[model samples]
Target: MTADSLPPWLRQPLAELLRQRGHAWLLQGPSGLGQYELGLALAAAWLCEQPEEAKAQGACGHCPSCHAIQVRTHADLCVLMPEVAMQALGWPLDEKSQADIDDKKRKPSREIRVEAMRDAIGFAQRTSARGRGKAVLIYPAERMNNITANALLKTLEEPVGEVRFVLASEAAWQLLPTIRSRCLGFTLPWPDSGQAQDWLVGQGVPAADAPGLLRAAGGRPSDALRLASQGQSPKAWSLLPKAMSRGEVGALSEHAPAQAIGALQKLCHDLMAVDCGALPRFFEPADLPPAPPRAALARWSRSLASAAKTAEHPFNAGLMLEALVSEARTTLNSASRRP
Candidate 1:
């Protein structure tokens, strides 16, 4: 996509980043804040063929370089992501890797492979295929395991030729300190609620569902859009807290174990907030049951956190969800007996 096509909240940041001079940049923040989008936009601006004046606004959408990126065929741009992310984002994998997976030799990797990093290092040393420079974009940079990160260290520290790098991550704290030390760090900004809501409507979310979805995502617009795309209705989200209190497993039955646990965690968080005489962040006060005792809520919160560690590989999703709901019911019922 063109740089101008990025979300409104990211445009100003794009311009700001373009004006800076850095061989390597680290764009970091929580998920759903467009770290990947901004990184790609910056890459495009660096490689854009447009005049300097037009480049300041971001990439010229009509340029050949921009089109190459749009179609994922830019010879000078190397994107490092998990195989799953590369496939989902429509970036073509190297022929060897694609053929291996096609032949069922092995499953696609979830982490950045060292082999890919080695290839990228070689690419960085090559002359620019186009008149402009080269770029390497790495998303979820934390996905790089130690071996892969180490492979990239030398190249990042003392780059050769006219190449630039942008590493975007949702969990920058997980990255190697050396990797973080080599790049200019930029944190993505959080858009205000009104701007987020308007953008959601622009993305075709029903205006009526915007507020509830926004709350469901903890005010992350990209997450809100994702929730809408997943068929999570605003009404169902609003009912989730009370449904858990009543021990209704079916309310969360459709979700994977990890997602179900996350929803429960948000519910637990809101209950704790209300117990402490503060407004809830994920659910409306009226939608929540009466506040449970702080001790009970705290216990439930700890359990949820522990469960989250293994939520991705539950022994039995059915049993796990039932137990989670049962505990929620017990904690929520404590509110009635608090007197």
Candidate 2:
């Protein structure tokens, strides 16, 4: 995105990070804190031909290097994301990998494959194709399985030419300490509330609705924008508590099984908070129904967690969702037996 369109909060950090020097970096923070965006910008700036200009104001958005990146055609950039993520980001897979996926030879791997890691290691060793140095941007680095991570560890430990690494993660603790020790670490900064709200408004979220969405996202602006983009609105979200309490499945029916379960999990979370006399974080307190019995909430929490483990590979999505919502209904409608 152009500097004009970049979120206000990310501007300074992006600029500051670009000015620093490092062959490898670990950008870690909780989900929705812009780790991926920051990592991409840092990589682009590194590969940008206009170093002086990019250093001052992030990537020069219109340069050939920047344009190549925007199109996912940058010769010197290797983005090592999960196959699913690579597909989502419009990054093309290697020809053989693409053919395999196209022919349904195997399912798209959710974990970065060892094969991809080996290719990246080779890429890192090659001379920079664009005269600028090479960069490997791995987002949600936690997704690397142990075997794949081990393959990348050697390259991370020792420098090979001008190749650079930017590993961005929401769950940094999942990484091997040895892998982490090889890179400089930068924790992402949380944006100020006012700044986030303003940026949300600028991104087409209604000004009045921004605060509620922002709160629903637990102050994560990227998540708030995603919620809005996915047809969620503040009003609809506020109605979720009461909807779940009444066993109304419609509030969550439109979402995929995983997403629906996630919303229910949040509702369960808030109900637990209300039971403990604490204000809710993801929903407006006044909009919530009376809290469920602690026993029921706990039971449902365990069940939801179990379901989350297999939510991605459900045998029958409709049945799975029905079962999940039914379980939620039982817990939400239960009452405390305590005097």
lDDT of 1 by residue, 72-176 (tens): 999999999999899988999999999999999988888999999999999999999997999999988999999999999999999998999999999999999
TM-score of decoy 2: 0.93
Candidate 2, residue 130: CA error in Å? 2.1
Model 2 residue runs over 4 Å out of place are 1-5, 51-54
Steric collisions counted per model: 0, 0
* Tens-digit per-residue lDDT, 220-288, candidate 2: 999999989888878888888777666677778888888888888888898898899888878888887
Each candidate's TM vs. the true structure?
0.94, 0.93
Task: List lDDT for all candidates, in order.
Answer: 0.92, 0.85
